[model samples]
Target: MMNLKYQMIIQWSEDKSFLVGFPEFPGQTWRTHGDNYQEAVNNGIEALESLVIAYQTTGETLTKPTFNQAA
Candidate 1:
């Protein structure tokens, strides 16, 4: 796999007793979680890697991450 990077956001869920991670990429949504912060991060990475592979297999172009440029 290419050295691609995607943005990951993690937050604590008071109702779930675990951290939730969301990767900002095309066709990706809430699909990973962890009992703790580290677990969430690890899960997020794995999820992103898997997503990239799936997209490649389907003959879809990889999603390019959006960036905020200062004016």
Candidate 2:
């Protein structure tokens, strides 16, 4: 796999659902049905990969999210 240096924030919601999002990739978020944190991270990665491919096909540039903004 290619090494893509993208950062994302993963947290558990109040309802126990995993909330994942890449602040750099605005509007990109995904949720998975599992208690495992790793599962959530994997789902988030898949979501990001899809978004990146879509953006590339359309000639759109991806905006990198900063740590401050993600926080």
Candidate 3:
């Protein structure tokens, strides 16, 4: 299990579904989506896991997570 902390942005799309995206990983805007909010979160987590695994399997460097400091 990968315990990497990354950003997952979920927003309602015009298609009437929730879209998920990872800001840390560029190039692709939307990765996984869902019909509802909960589903979107679940799909986002799965997508994040797969992304990390893919990066590791390919011996590629994983992007550093952005830490937002509390003001």
Candidate 4:
């Protein structure tokens, strides 16, 4: 699990599902989603964890967050 916090954007799509996006990661516009908001958030977190692992395995530096997070 990654301790770093990245931005997760959850929005309602026309398909009537929650679309999840990671603005900090440079890849697909929408990473993962779900039928509901909670599901979307859970999926997004899992996707983010996988993404972090992928970057680490590839020895690629992650992009800096666009916004600062409050402690």
Give Cα-based local distance difference scores for all models: 0.70, 0.70, 0.92, 0.89
Structural RMSD, model 3: 1.0
- lDDT of candidate 3 over 1-71, digit per residue (tens): 56869999999999999999999997648999999999999999999999988899999998899999999
Q: Rate residue 44 of model 3 by lDDT.
A: 93
Arrange candidates, best TM-score first: 3, 4, 2, 1
lDDT minimum window of 10 residues, candidate 3: 21-30
Off by over 4 Å in 3: none
lDDT of 1: 0.70
For candidate 1, what is the TM-score?
0.72
| TM-score between model 4 and native | 0.87
Cα RMSD of all models vs. native, in order, equals 2.9, 3.7, 1.0, 2.2
Query: Who wins the TM-score comparison?
Result: 3
> Could you say which candidate leads in lDDT?
3
**Model 1 Cα lDDT, one tens digit per residue, 1-71:** 45655677777786664544444564456667888878887787787788778888999887677666699
C-alpha RMSD (angstroms) for model 2: 3.7
TM-score of each: 0.72, 0.72, 0.93, 0.87
